[model samples]
Structure formats: C-alpha cells, structure tokens
Target: MNRTNCGYPLLFPRQNWRHYALRSLQFAVALYLLAFFLFPVGFLFLKALQNPDGTMGWGIIALLFANPVSWESLQNSLIVATGAACLAGSLALAAAALFWKSDIRPSPFMELCGFLPLFMPAFVLASSLDIIVGGHGGLPAMLQNLLGISRANASLLSLTLIEALHYFPFILIALHLSTRASSPQAHAMARLGTSWRRLIRQVFVPLALPGLAFAMALTFLKVIDDLATPLALGITNMLAPQAYHRIAVYGAQDPLAALIAAILFITSGLAWFASLGFIRQNVNLFPVTFNDNRPPPTSASMRGRFFITFLGVVYLGCYAGLILSSLAGVWSHTPLPETYVLTHYLKAFRFEMSSLYNTLIYCGFAALIDILVALPLAHAIAKAPPHWKQRLGWLVAGTLCIPGVTLGIAYLALFRDIQLPLSNLPLDATGLLLTLAFSIRGLPFALHICSLALNSVPASYIEAARTLGCAPAKIVSRIVFPMLRFGLLLAFTLCFSLAAVDLSLAALLVPNENNAPLAYSIYLHIQSPSGMNVGSALAIISFALLALILFGIIHRLHRRQGSHRTLSPPLFPTHRTTGFAHESSHH
Candidate 1:
C-alpha cells in the first residue's frame, strides 16, 4: 500500500537525488516557457471564445467565419506565403547546388551579395519596397510614364518582388546547411559517369530535401507572421496586418485570429514533424565516410562563372537599394542616384537609441540565459540512454513548427492574472515579459544548435577526463567547453539577431512607449506622417547595428580559427561565408 502512494519509498538515496534533480530542472524550465510564451497564446484562444460582455463564448470565432474580410485576409496570407516559399526555395536550391556540386569557381564577392537580405530587417524591406513604388519619383511613376501602366496596378507586383528578395536569404540558410552535407557526396559522384542532372535528381535532391523542407516551413512561418509588408504594400486584407489592425483599431478582438493561428500552427507543426521523422529514419542512410582520396574536381566553365556572378549581382542589387536609400540624399531617385550622405545615419543613431537599447537588453540577456539552460539540457540529452535518442531528438525540434503568434499569445494568456509569490510584480512589465518571450522563443533554435554541438563532442574526451580523476566541472571547463565555444557563440548571435528584429509579440504585449524595443519603435514611427523619415532613419540604424554585430562575429570566428591553424585544416576552405551571423552555420 505504501509503495503505491510513495514514489521514493523503495528508492536508493542517490537514485532519488538524481531523479528529483532532473525532474525539478525540467519542471522549472517548462514553467518558465509556459509562463512567458505558451500561456498568452492560450489566453488569446480563450479570448476568441469569449462573448462581448466578457463572458466565455464562441462568438469571436463565429464572427471570423461570418465576415468575408477576415476570411479573405487569411486566404491572401496563404497565397503570399506559398508564393514566397516557392521563389525562395527554388533560388536557394539553385545557389546551393551551384556552390555545393559544380566546380563553380567560388565567388566570395558574389556570396556577399547573395546574402545581403540576411542582414536587412523585415520593416526595412517593406519600407524600401514601398518607397520604390509609391514614394515621390519612385519606379511606379517612371513605369506609369514610360510603359503606361498605372501605379496601382504596378504596386502589388512590386511589393511581392521585394518580399521574395527579402525572404530568400532565410530559405537560403536552411538550403546551405542541408546541402553542405550533400556537396561532398555529390562532388565525388560527379566524377563518375552520372550526369549533372541525374546526380542532382538522385543524390543531391533527396539528401538536401530535408533542408529544403525545413526552409519552406520556416519561410511559411516568417511570411505568415509578417506585419510590416501589408502596411507597406497597402493590403489591408493581409493576415498579419489584419490581426494587428483587429486588435489595434477594430477593438473587436475577432476570435478568427485564434482559429487561423491554430490552423497555421497545426499545418506547419505536422510538416516539421514529418520531416524530422524522415530525417531520423535516414540520419545514417548515407554513412558520412569520406572519399578523401578522390575529392571531386570542378570544371567551372567561363559561362557558368559569368552566370553565377550575374545572378549574384542581381541578388545584391535588391538590398543595395536599401543600403543606398538609407543613406541617400533626401531628393535623390532613379538609377545611379547622387551622393550618399551620413546625415541620415547621424539622425538615425540619435533617434533610435531607446529601441537599440531595448534590443540589446532583451536579446543579450535572453540568449545568454537560454544558452545556459540549454547547455545542460543538451548535455543530458546527449548522455541519455541510447534507446531514447530518436524520441528525445524530435521532442526538442517539435517546438520549431509552433507558430510565432501562438507563442506570443501564450505569454498573454499565462500572465494575465498570474503573480509571483514573493513580489507582486505583474507579468505585463514589457522587459520581463520580453526576456521570457525571447528565451522561450529562442529555445527551439538554441536546443537544436546545442544538441549538434554537444553531440560532436566525442564521448572519449569526457570518459578520459573522468578516468584521470577530474571533477565534472573540471572536465566541462576544459575539454567539453573548449570545443563548444564556436557553437555557443553561433547560437547566441542568431538568437540575438532574431530577438532584435522581432515585432509581433513585442507590439502586442509591451504597452508602454518607454519599454518599447526597436521593432515597436519603428512600427510607431511609421504610423504617423511626421515620423516617416525618422522611422526610415531608425530602420537604417537598426540595420547597421545588425550588420555590425554580424561582422564582429565573423571577425571573432576568424581570430579563433586563426589560432587553431596548426591542428584544424582551415576555417575557410572557401572564403565565401556570408556576413549575417545567423546565416553563417547550422550548428
């Protein structure tokens, strides 16, 4: 009878200690995630069920289906997302294939151009696209005069072009990481009689499909969650802006947003789940044994090289417009526009301080904390009984497919009336809420990266250190950690960049202007006529900060690799890594 009632009644003291410690840690992290990211999402869903008199009801969801506008917006969002995913996925596949398989003469410069979008924030792309279309002396005006096409007719296509360009880099990174695993294999196969097309279809495509699918899912999430482009493109029926406007202007709090978000979450989550299961089934299908004896030789033809450079230039031109526009003389327009000025930058720095500060405070703290929690979890996962490996792996990546808005909504729901036992602080404090949100949001990415890093650390090292009578701390501080620095740095940089640009949750949860971050600040500035230049300037400043951070990371990695030159073959077998820190690597 006692055995049924008491969990530890028959347990050994050491076993009890280990079990309780692990469970306690798990409980704490789970609570933290739910409190900041999941609960608010639940709250939003609950709100959708509530009646107008604050009573629980399904009227919100009913209104969503009944209203054509709401349904239309959701439909439009799906269309746009699908289009962006296709364009991005195809382009990334081509570029990755070129770099990975063919003896494509490596173009370091072209690589830089191709990846410029990685550094550009979402709002800036939207703004630049808008300016290119609707602003005074913009392309629409020229097209209207030359081709006799109306500006209204040209604007939608123009915005789509801009979004495709901006979203492409996200898909590209996933493609790059996915294909890197295949490139070496494909190269060796190319030397055989297998034709390029056949090799691509057989070896490269199947192997890289995982990355491609992952990219598409991520792009879908990003594009669907986007709030800036609709405003820039002037599409009121776009899903993101609709949800934004619903809460901000309508005050109606339509339950449809919740239903739509649930749909999005379910769809993407299923895709990611299927992909992970596929990956696990095939993780070792291609044993990674290398043909070091016969590495593939490339025959990059002159025409191929030229085509690569041309395509790279086209990619570069998209973001160059923003880089140029951000620093443009106020009146300049058209091809090869006049002198670049620093005045815009000076103004930007002056005005964007609060937003910049908030970005740093939140991203820095949250990413760092996420890493600390994650490192332990990763270590445990890596060391867990081998039987649990595949199950736990998917368990971690399952969070990737969760919709961004759902996480934001979760935070809102969980914290509405919740309080801490010690201090009576409300969860509504934007900074606190933001820190938690960012951390929980970052968990999936961080966990993925850390798991890979930890797995790469050979068990032999830990075992040898233990045999030498080294303490657990000593072993970790020495062997395990030294090899993990690069991965941890990569994880932190990516998490920071993401948090810096995040607008959805911050916009919804952070009510005070004083507590606002860069994304919110830009959103507010863009809301008013007087604030356009200031907003543009602020946007440019945020872009520069992101770029600088990226540069600093690359510089550090170079320095680290430089010192390890004697042992490690080389960091840049091809010096074509992009500037964006997030785009640098998978692990």
Candidate 2:
C-alpha cells in the first residue's frame, strides 16, 4: 500500500497541511493574549487581595474603602467623569447637527482644529489653560481686575473644561459618521412631510445613540483614568493621581495602590460594559453603504460659516498661552510677555533630546508590534464561526478596560522578579516592558482598523487563489498584503501617536528619569519655575513633530493612490451585531 494513502501517514498529507497551520496560528494567538494581557491583569487583582503573610483575603480592599480619602477620590472621579462626558457629548452633538443641516464644507484649517486634540496629551491642555488662568498666569490679574473672578475659582472650572475640550472630538467624529450613515433615512423621512423636530426625535436620536454612547463612555474612561492632567492641575484628590502617588511614594508593592488600581479597573470595565449594552440595543441602526453622494456646497450659509469659524478660532485660542510661554522672556503678571526670545527652544533642544528619542523608540516599536499581531488576529476573527467570532471580538474589546496605570502596576507586580535573558536586570527595569504595555493598550485600535480593512477585501479573490492551490503564505503576500497596506499604515500611525501622548503609562512605567518619555519630561520641567519655558517649548516641538509625521504619512498615501482622497472618520463598533457583525458574516 502507498504510504500516502495509509490511514496513518508518517507525515501529514499536503491537503491537510493548511488546516494544521491555521490551528497552530490560532493556538499561538491565544497563547500570546494570555501571556501578555490576561496574566498581568489577573495578577494585579490577586495582589490586591493578598495579605502581608502571603494569605489571600479581602483585608487590603476593605482597608482601602475604609479610608475617607479613598472614598472622596472615588466620588470626585465619578463626578468628573460624568460631567466631562456630558459636556463633550453635548458640544459634539450640537456641532455635528449644525454641520449636517447646513451641509457646510469644512476647510482644511477647520478640520485640523477639530482633530488636533487627539494628537495632544491631556496634561498639555491642562497646562495651557493654567498658563492663561492660573494664579501667576498672564491673564489672571487682568481677568480678576475686570471680571471679578478669582484665579482659584477659574482654575477649578478650567479643569473640567479642559478635559471636555480635549475629548469632544471623539464624539464629534462619531456623530459625523453616524449622520452620514443615516442621511438617506433622514431624506426619506423629510420627503414624507416629516417635520425637522419629529425627524430628529425619531430617526436621528436612535441612529446616533450607539455612536454617542460609545464615544461618551470612552470619554468617561479617559477622564477617570487620566493621571497627568489631575497631577498637572495640582488636583491630587482624584483616584488616578491618588493611585499614582501611592505607587510612586510607597513603592509598587503597596497594597493601597493595588486596591486603588483595582477600583479604577472595575469602574472602567463597568463603563465599557454599559456602553456595549447601549450598542446592543441599537444594532440595526447602521446602514451598510458608506458613500455620501451629496454635492459639495458652492456657498455655505453665512451664519453657518461664522459659527464654524468662531468655534475654530475659540478652540485654537485656548493654546495661545502655550505658544507665548514657549517664546516669552518674562512679564508673567502682564497680559503679554515683556520680551520674546528663542532661549527656551534652544534649551529644550539641548536637554530634552533624550526624552524625545525615547518617545520615538518606544512608541515606534509598540506600533510595529501592534500591526504584526493585529493582522493575524483580525483575519482569525473574520474567519471564525459565529459563536467563536462573538467571543473573540469581546475578548479583543476587553483590552480597552485595562487602564494604563493598572497595566503598569500589573507589569511591575507580575514581572518584577523575572530576570531578563543573559542580563541581571528584571523585565520591568527595561524599556521593553513599557513598549509591551503600549502594544497591549493599543491592540484594540489596531485590530479595529485591520478588521475593517480585511472586510473590504473580496472573498472571491481569496477563494480563487485558493482554488489555484496557492499556499496561505503566497495568498497573503501576493494578494492580501497589497490590499491591506493602507489599513496597516493607518493602524501604525494611530498606535504610535496614541502611545507617544500617553502620559499615564510613561509616568508609571519609566524605570528612571534618564529613560523618561517626552510627556513625563515635560511634566518634570513644568514643575520647576525656571524650567516652565523649556517645558512649553518642548510641548510645542512635540506637537509639531507628531503633526509633521502624520502629514507626511497622509501625503505619501495620497501620492501612492494618485488621488486627493481625504481621510474617512473612524467608526466605533457597536455591539456584536453592527461593526463586527458584517465582518463575521462577510465570508
């Protein structure tokens, strides 16, 4: 008998090799998720429960809740989070609605204003506002003299407004996309004699709820988990800063810090779960078609144009103090600086080069790792069976609940004693751990884009290639990779930018000041009176660098496509039935 035809062949048959390869790939992905994500987070929870004698109990958690400061911090975090979400959502909803009704074409400058906050760190916003309104700020004396407002009260008010301003774009983008998706319905309703109010009440609200809920939930999580902003504002009573303080002062092994991190984790997870519930209820809202065939406006309404311009100007005006601080020589008590100079910029370049380099190296590696893992994970989810697809999608989405501080704490706790190969240093002592943390944090974003890209590819093309007996490697390299190049590029850019601006992770994960990322370095500089100008200069440089990188990537992409295609706003996935629903069913 031929060995190949035997019931038990020595080697696997050629036809079944692909199946084995796929199984191996799935196994590898599962292992990676467990090792990098599940274990660290799980250990953090365990650390919070463990007693000093190594016994497992709830004593630490109980002690945490028993403290009045902890209760106060928790209450403050919830209040701030809720308020910021509402404010951001309201602003975005109004802006999006106005734009939709007027059909105004946004200028490139307007577009930049709307999206600029996404590329900046929240602390930068907080600091900029402080420079304008703090006790020793340029405008505080002037404002106090004219408006009868104290700098103290203004600083308090600015904290929430700063967060709201920084995060509103997320909701704005979501609302814009949802409006486009539901435009046909709106027009249909309008043609049937439906009033504007009724149309908004019935069709617009329901269609927009999924996107709004997801975006607002995201905002809430961001505000609650934000460490640098609260710290920069000198508001250490919030949960994030409290946890950071405990870890920084008491060491990573502090039980109170672990408990506080646990609280933050639970709170974030609950918020995310709530958003998913809202998304589930509105699963049928999105239309499959993405194109908008409406004619470009030849002349926008004067009122609409004025409103757009006013908002753009006001938003950009918030950063005026930051610009001046970077260039100002002195005259802090005046409305403007006495003299302008390049000394701050020169100092930033001289002393902060290491910090800037650290950011690029760490965030760049993290982005690379994100795309590498995201491609296979996205493909696997697309090809999974219905039940498994939902499970895998949720598993990936769960990564968003892991706050940066919590993840950093988990890394320190879980990997503290694990020595690196061929080195005496522990894993937590090197930049590798920081890069890995960033990768885990950014995986969900990368996966979302990758899945969308993979969904765009025609199944028939893949099936035909398979019919020709092309190997999986050949299919991916020859066909899939070419189509996925743009999406991969976008994923990398998003991950890199997000990581670079992550002050929370950098604050907690850096082993020493020498290895600090630019965000942390800026924070340190700002804390010193003499170094404030240098910090402001560094912040501007960071902003410019990120903007240039993004512009270059987008320009290159445009040239490659041989068209002036603008970027499409990113869409958030609703529950199992909307975004990934199509992905799962595409095959």
Candidate 3:
C-alpha cells in the first residue's frame, strides 16, 4: 500500500462500493459540465455557422466581415474596452493605495465604500446616470453650454464613466490583496529610505505586475461583454447590445446574433487565458510567508488625502444619485428635483411585488444548487490523485473566463426546447431553465470559495479523525462541514446575489415577466417609456437589499475570521504598490 502523509493510502478506496460511488459522482459531474457548458458553447458555434436550411453557410461569415455595422460594433467594443480597462485599473490602483496603505481614518469603512459598486448591478448604475445626467438634461445641458459638446457625446462619456466606476472594485480588491501579500518587501524597501514613487517603480509594480495585468484584462473583457450598460443607455451599436438586439428582434432564428456571440466568446476567452497566464507566471515573483503580523501603516501624504477624498466624493455622488432618482418626482430644468415623491416606489411595488417572490425563489434554488454541487466538486479536486488535481482544477475553472453574455446566448440556443432528465418537464417551463442557468453561471465562484476553504483545513486534523476510526461520512459531517460553515455561507450568499442580479442570463433565459428577476425587471422598466422612474425605484430597492444582506453577512464573517485568521485573497487577481499612481498616469 502506498501510504500518504495523512496515514491514508495514496489510492484510498478499499471497498468496491466507495470506488463505484466516487466514479459515479465523477461521471455525473463530467456529464453536467459537458452538457451545460462545453456542448452548449459548441452548439453556439454551429448555430453561428449554419444556414436557415440547417446546412453549412459560409455566406453569413462573409456578411459579418462586410457589414459596416459589424465592423463598427467591433471597433467600438475595442475602444470602449481599452478605455474602460485603463481607467478602471488606474483608478483602482490609486484608490487601493490611499485606503489600504496610507494612515487613513476609518479605513474599514473606506474599504467597504470602495467595494460597494461590486455588489451593485450595472443596470442600476446606468439608470442612475440616466436620471442625473440625461433624464433631466442637467449635466448635458451644462456641458453643452460650457464645452459645446452634444447630449449624445455626454451620454457616451457618462456610459464610459459609470462602467469604469462599477469595475474599479475588481482591480481595487485584487491590488489590495496583492500589495498586502508583498507588504514585507514594501516595508523593507521603505526602511532603505526609498521614496514612495521609486519603491513602487522598483519593487511593488514589478511584484504586482501579474495582478495588474489580470485586472486590466478582466475589466476589458467585462466592458466588451456587458449588455446591460449599453442597452440601458440606448447604445445598440455596440457589440453586446447589438447581438442581444438581433436575438430580441429576430428570435433564435438569427445567425447574426450567434456570430456576434462567437466573437465575444473568442475575445473574452483570450483575455481570460491571458490573465491566468500572467497571474501564474508572476504569482511567486516576490513570494512572502503568509502571516497575521500587521505592517505599520505608512505616513499619509497631503496628496494621498486629496486623492482619497476625490474618490469618496465620486462614489458618494453616484450612490446618492441612485437613491434620489428613485424618489424624485420631476426636475427637468433645475439641478435638483422639483418634488420628492414616494409614488414611484408605490407603483413599482404594485406591478413587481410578485417579482420579489420570483427573485427570492430563483436565487434560493440557485444558491442551494451551487452549494450542493460545488462542495463535492471541490472535495474531489482537492483530494484527487496528484496527477488528476491540475486537470480537475482547470475543468472547474473552465467557465471563469467565459463572458456571462456568451453563456446566456449559448444556453438559449441549446436549452430552448430541451427536456429535463428523469422528468416529463421541459427545461424552459416555469423558469426552471433560468434557475439552472444561474446555477451554472455561479458555479465557478462557489467552487473557488469552497476550494479555498477546503485547502485551509489541516491534513493532520483529518488524519487524526481517521485514526480514531471515524467513518468518512461522520468525519465530513462533524469536522469538514463545521469548518466550512462560514465559507459556505459566504459562497451561498455571493452565488444567490449574483444570480438575482444577472442581467445576461435573465434577459435571454427569462421567457416572460413572471420569470424575470430584479435585474431583468429593472431592464424592462428602464426600456419602457412609462416605467423609467419605476425602474429607478426598483433599482434602488434591489441595490439596498443586496448591500444590506451581503454587507451584513460579510462584516460578521470578517470579524470572526479576523479574530484568528487573516482575510481571503482578492476575488479577482490584481496587484498594488508603494503609493497612489500619479494622476497624470491616467491621461
């Protein structure tokens, strides 16, 4: 027997039943991943390449190449993505340095505020911008008067601005974690009398290059694949909205939509792979021991204070605009609303009260499914034979790079009329299909969180239990489950909130208003002429509820973990350095 470090055999299965069970579980997981993810994506390519008569069609490919709008959409996507990536990454880098590295007052609250937009759905932010900047024509009018810019130009800029704000948190968190990981090196460099600027240039930036690249790549992919922002802003010429528009106008029969989806799929896939490569290549560039010893905060500079204050004002303005827009009755010509009214909320609730139930039910089911499936999957990967671990990890992470829009389109193409296994029920009936879609979309997040939790558990603890003659089932229940409770809670909450606010999946997978979650409902409201205020109201409510629940749970988890262990690594891979990047760097 090949005994392992934990006193278990390298190939631990002694009973035939256990081996059969493990094989069965692996088979089931593989089947689901293939059917839901890989096969559907492959089907999307087939649909993109096929003629109306179900035969191969190369003419559509040529049409995509020749169409001016297709080319323009692609161009606009590249421009927007590049611009958003640069802006977001730069802003995040600056903000992370001030809030985390400097000796700022109320650092915890500042960090939370910085992270607020990550939990907010993009549509909510878009609606808020429309209300403050475009709905009343206040900011656009002011810009027109001062700079001779047109309202259309103002709207586009606002769109870009809001996108950068929404994505800033991804890079901010990434850089924050990466910087913390290299704090010892940073402090050592500081003791050598290195200026902040040079320290960043010589040590911090180089060490955190992987995280910065990952953040930029992730942001670019997100901006290009985003459907809600462009759609809410009435910018149908962009690639994501254009693809969605074709599907809405021509239904599933449109190959052009599939073609556009294929493009997004390829673009996002490449970005995702590039980010992973960067992170892997540089993760150990300046490796340090993980510990709880806190580094002394650096002295705050006047410049850092000013930068932090400016970012705070921006976030406060956006959040306030969202809340006020929901309550404002009208203010066409003035900077402020003419009257504050609660009617919007009243009307919105009257119409969408049922949608609240729908949101809760779908999110609840999605969370349950994610936890159930991801836990076992994480266990299998972490405990697998060493030869199989890397392959299994990659398989779980396969969808991490796929854009939500691409997955939404692929699911629509494949599950439009499919039947559920072992039941007479069709997949598309009564929002069941949407539920499954949300689960699949959120699986990667759940798996990642659980894997971290599982890996954190000591091998000696499990070995001791086994030596005491504990059954595997009992050990899992008494030891592993208890240890993972906080992580599982966090994962479930994140998965549920994500599902509830997923615009891409909800837009395509939801067949009717009854199936619409809060995000899709907000989209429909924003798009309807009579329902914009109602949409704003709904956005406010959803944003508030999500912030409250997620923040409350996360705060409690952090406090508990802080007592004994350190925080988890950043959700996205980004890195930071010695000080705020110079403001001119953004230019």
Q: What is the C-alpha lDDT of each candidate?
A: 0.60, 0.74, 0.70
In every candidate, how many clashes are there? Answer: 11, 0, 1
Q: Candidate 2 residues 287-341, lDDT tens each?
A: 2222335555534345567877787677678888789899999765798899999
Task: After superposing candidate 3 on the true structure, give the runs of residues whose Cα lies further than 4 Å from its correct spot.
Answer: 1-12, 97-115, 134-155, 181-188, 280-306, 330-332, 346-351, 385-388, 419-426, 562-564, 567-587
Judge candidate 3 against the unseen true structure and give its global Cα lDDT, from 0 to 1.
0.70
Ranking by TM-score: 2, 3, 1
For model 1, how does the per-residue alpha-carbon lDDT over 142-216 read when each residue is reduced to its tens digit?
Answer: 555767776654544455555677777556545554455555555566667668898777666765565576557
Best by lDDT: 2
Query: Model 2's lDDT to the true fold?
Result: 0.74
Candidate 2 off by > 4 Å = 1-22, 105-115, 134-157, 181-193, 280-300, 466-472, 556-587
In candidate 2, clashing pairs total 0
Candidate 2 lDDT score at position 23: 63
Clashing pairs in 2: none
